[model samples]
Target: MTETPETAETPFDRAAEFDRQVRTLVDRGYPSLAGVGPEAFAAAVAPLRDRATATTGPCDIDGGRIPFLLVVARGAAPIEETMPRTTLHRGRLPGFVDRSFEPGSLERFVVPEEIGLPDGDIYLLLDVERGEEFCGVVPGEAMKTVAERKRTPLTIEEGVALVTHFPEVLAKNKCFSLGGSRCGDRRVPALWISKRAPKLGWCWEGNPHTWLGMASAGGRSAG
Candidate 1:
């Protein structure tokens, strides 16, 4: 007798898994930034900058909304960027720290330490070009729980389908591309899909991949 094939999971399933992982991390205190020394903190955040560079294609932080640089220097005082003059300062570090703790804040800032505190004269710097940057420290156990949750990786086909079916929603939500080409299709109206929706899975508080920003007017009209 022939055996039956197992059903493949859908994109929604994979996204749900990702959400579960995020929730688990949040629950277990996965994104806390504590106990990390200055050097380790800087080293830890290096990859996020690299990712931003790779995705944005070597563009200067000038005029950019998100921060690109994460520096852990030898002082509690903020390290200022010499060139731009407008954005370099100590007060900015809090914003970066806050991002890790607050839900809906991670998309705004990338926290490398995720769950550690800077030891001694360690200071953090974020490369903010256009918009502002922010961060915060969270409980360790909470972050661990978040990390423990499982994630379902997305296949290329599923990724494409998600973008195609929900172009506007994806673009508006900033959920489609983590670090790659900008979502290039015509901007669609922002569709807010709650993360707890039963159709998807009861996980995050909001759509995992959606942003609130509007598309450029110069881009193709969505009407």
Candidate 2:
């Protein structure tokens, strides 16, 4: 049978490819997560599946496409907004907002509204030297919750508490085991060999940066 163009598999679909590896991690454990393969994430994000934004191009981290959504929530504001203090960095992964250097430092972003995103939207987010930050979304409000529109970045502890309280978002990973790069301390989530999944090792601090590093989704999926 011929696969529809919409359903056809491309050679380098990164998100689908990573999802496939997650299934493999499950297969390896055969019903025991052992702290890896964050499959519960799938169920948590289910409410927004119909609301996911479509893209024909690959994700910046993987250079391949996946079903991850770009939120454009309803009643979203129409102005292009950005965090005035946010710093940019070049790391192996995409979607990272370079700010936090220590475990207690606060990283920040404007909600979809300020960015003209549709209401009630969610998307994949990545970070270096830290656990992945996908749950940064606030369900019913913009992330910046001040009348003046200024947010106090959540302390790492505070942020992790809210996100991982569900048992689905194990974002305690600071990736500090992997030392910082000469450029900076950027790392990604990782899986270990002893069956403790998502152990968080390997640094992205090297020259000749490849988009796919051990911390990146593509490199992890390919591994």
Candidate 3:
């Protein structure tokens, strides 16, 4: 009998998944959106590709939780670039922001200093959780629970990256909130399946939604 590859336990092939992510970003023109050349952007993420292959186990899909090694483009890149590129429906449908929000308004949403994100133009988010367990809970309460767990809430850019790389994670009745980024106000940004497509929208902090959960991550790594 031959020894089995550990990836057999995973829902998808890790190497293939990683390749798809990279190819999607390159194909979707994410490099230019981030003000970088396509080849340079691909080179920058080459290390992550190497790292993914070297890792063992099931690639963090245990019990239906999808853990992502997110390659986030922030700082130099405007939110507008990443937001509209988030795709679903097998990359056919493009993402859109709620009509209520005007272009460039997302700049007000800032990551809290407490999150201690790594400094970089590009960075890595490790073991990102979609926070499915927090559905039906208000953002305020869910945030408290997240703090108790010692996990960091995900920013808008990070949330976009999750769906961009792994659109399958954004399932029906399983949308998530981006409480990690906020202005000095009551609004919380979120991504959900809206009008048969992926949407970047906002909800009140005090509100609860049975369909939406808070997204979070183990931490950030400097790329």
lDDT of each: 0.23, 0.24, 0.75
- The residue-level lDDT of candidate 1 at 100 comes to 17
Give a tens-digit lDDT track for model 3, residues 1-223.
0112236453445567666777877877878776788889878777676555544334443222444555665675566777678777465677887876666778788888788677666666766788888899999899989989888888988888887776777888888999999888999999999766789898899999999999887777763
Residue 179, model 1: Cα distance from true site in angstroms: 18
Q: Arrange candidates by TM-score, highest first: which order?
A: 3, 2, 1
Off by over 4 Å in 1: 1-33, 46-53, 58-62, 65-223
Candidate achieving the largest TM-score: 3
lDDT tens digits, residue span 152-200, model 1: 1121122222222222223212322111111222211121223211011
Each model's TM-score, in the order given?
A: 0.19, 0.23, 0.85
The count of residue-pair clashes in candidate 2 stands at 8
List the candidates ranked by lDDT, beginning with the highest.
Answer: 3, 2, 1
Model 1 quality (TM-score): 0.19
User: What's model 1's lDDT at 82?
Assistant: 10
- Better-scoring candidate (lDDT), 1 or 3: 3
Instruction: Output the number of the lDDT-best candidate.
Output: 3
